[model samples]
Target: MNGDWLAEGRAELAAERILDAVRMLFVEKGASAVGMAEVAETAGCSRATLYRYFDNRQALYVAFAGREARQLIERVWLNRSINSEAGRADQLLDAIASVLAEVRKTPHLAVWFEPANSGIVAQLSNSSDVIDAIGAGFVAGYRPALTDSAARLLGQWMIRVVVSLLTLPGGGEDEERAMLRNFVMPFLLDDTTTIE
Candidate 1:
């Protein structure tokens, strides 16, 4: 049992190292352009070793994105201040702003949002179970009465809004906030709204 635990720990560390190396390459070159052999060389590991951790480039990208998403969510929640008396809309607006700021400021994350790479980022994010769960958790927090399916749908919509903004920013923060408040909040917060 002890040896098994140790081996598991080592495996996780190796995977993390590979991910770290990949982040740099992503920043230097868009994510779609990166390949497994380059990742192996950058990580200082053989291609076989790299494949042992991640079966293919897609697997590695998913792992990296999932890890980053979790960390980003944690950081956004930790640093954001929510006024207990504020309306749900206000709280959600704050959360969105925090997330946008966090991702924009983080170099590794910002790269993924660049126009050249945004399509890949969107595809991965929309398909990722991890991201969907995180987004659903946000929906549940604001509207606890929603069914799981409804919340999940709304959560995905919220993610799409964020991605759209990141891919092509609005006039400024004020404009962005207004767009969310005027356009998104109505459809998003309306209990009677049905998503198909």
Candidate 2:
């Protein structure tokens, strides 16, 4: 039993090290452009070992993205000061703005949003269940009355909005905030309305 626990610990450590190494590569070369051989070399692991941890580049990307997305969500919530007295729309705008600022400042994350890489980012964002859960969690904070399916749908929409802004930002931060406030907040504020 002790040996099994030790082996598991070691495996987790090796996987984390590989992920750390790949993060730097993602920063330098952009996420979509990175290849498996490059990840193995950067991670100081044999291709066999890298493959053992991640079946393919897509799996590796999903793992890395899931980890980063969870961390980003935690940071955004931790740093934000939510005023209960503020209107829901105002509060939602603040949350969106905070998330955007966090992604923009994080190097590995920002690289995912670069024009050349945004397509891959969008695909992953749309497909990843981890991301969907994160979005649902965000929506739940604001609309606790929503059913799980409704929250998940709204969460996905919110994520799509964020990705759209990241892929093609507005004229500036003020403009982006204005767009969110004007366009996104209304739909969000009405929890009774069905999406699609």
Name model 1 segments beyond 4 Å from true.
Answer: 1-8, 78-85, 194-196
The CA lDDT at 184 in model 1 is 85
lDDT tens digits by residue: candidate 1, 49-96: 889899988789888988898999898874554436457678778788
- Evaluate all candidate structures by whole-model CA lDDT and list the values in order: 0.83, 0.84
Off by over 4 Å in 2: 1-6, 78-85
- Model 1, residue 69: what's the lDDT? 89
Clashes of each: 0, 0
